[model samples]
Target: MTTDPLSATFAALADPTRRAMLARLAEGEATVNELAEPFSISLQAISRHVKVLEQAGLITRSRDAQRRPCTLRLAPLDDAVDWLEEHRQVLEGRLDRLEVHLRTIQQKNQEHDQ
Candidate 1:
């Protein structure tokens, strides 16, 4: 299926296995077998998860002898972070306006109570 790069990235990251794989890769690179070690699932499962990450461009796999070692690329993740941060700033601005409004209302209530 076709998706925007950011959507593809977030979708790829939606799985816990993929997230774990990414976490493992963050320590550097490892073959599929090494990445599969921490989990109870089969190596095939881990390979599929790695494929998702590869499709998302979050990881890169290079051929080292007979093994394809997956390495963390991370460049695509910046788009996801940037998207979240943009919305966060907008939400914070709305919250700041609400705080000011509440403060004004509280001050008026205090003044009228006198």
Candidate 2:
């Protein structure tokens, strides 16, 4: 259930469970059983989440005997953050202009009333 890195990232983030898994992984690596312990769901569900994260390149799984430890791979998120930052900057600039415009109108209205 994957298309590309961007699509995979967006798809993985579409589910709350996967996001939580990433949050937990941010602290450190964990096995499937360890990740499953925090949620009320089963380990299978956590496995699915880990798979999605892995596909998104937001996480990785390594074999350690019988345990497959999940680790956060946050490098991919840097691109996402940069994208968001650019959009945010544009919106903030627009808002600043709107504020200035509103202030100009307000000042003119005050002068007219006086």
Candidate 3:
């Protein structure tokens, strides 16, 4: 387990099965068997994937009588998304500056052609 929440979230998302599980959970909470039904893997495998998601803080499992329903946890995901958006804004700003510089060069070229 990484000390960084973002890194842990990314790591958890890196697995396709886990990503699919998250998507399924997004619709609503599901039992382990429900989450495992879409894939050919064993229930144990799904349980392992669920454990990783739980560790990453992406999902929470609560007991409802005999069922342990897994619900999606949005806080870590929101934080990850916020982090990505921050970097995206920084890149967009750089691209905006580049666009301005290119426009200036184009204007200079037009003047020279004239």
* Candidate 1 accuracy as lDDT: 0.91
lDDT of 2: 0.84
TM-score of 2: 0.84
Candidate 3 lDDT over 1-114, as tens digits, reads 346889999999999999999999999999999999999999899999999999989999999999889999999999999999999999999999999999999999999999
Q: lDDT of each prediction vs. the true structure?
A: 0.91, 0.84, 0.95
- Encode model 1's per-residue lDDT on 1-114: one tens digit a residue: 788899989999999989988998899999989999999998788878888899999999899789888899878988899999999999999999999999999999999998
Q: State how far residue 79 of model 1 sits from its true place (Å).
A: 1.7
For candidate 1, the per-residue lDDT at 80 reads 91
RMSD (CA, Å), each prediction: 1.5, 2.0, 1.7
Q: What is the lDDT of residue 6 in candidate 1?
A: 91
With candidate 1 superimposed using the best TM-score fit, by how many Å does residue 67's alpha carbon deviate from the native?
1.4
Give the least accurate 10-residue stretch of model 1, judged by summed lDDT.
42-51
Q: Best by lDDT, which number?
A: 3
The ten-residue window of minimal lDDT in model 3 covers 1-10
Better of 1 and 3 by TM-score: 1
**TM-scores vs. true structure, each candidate:** 0.88, 0.84, 0.87
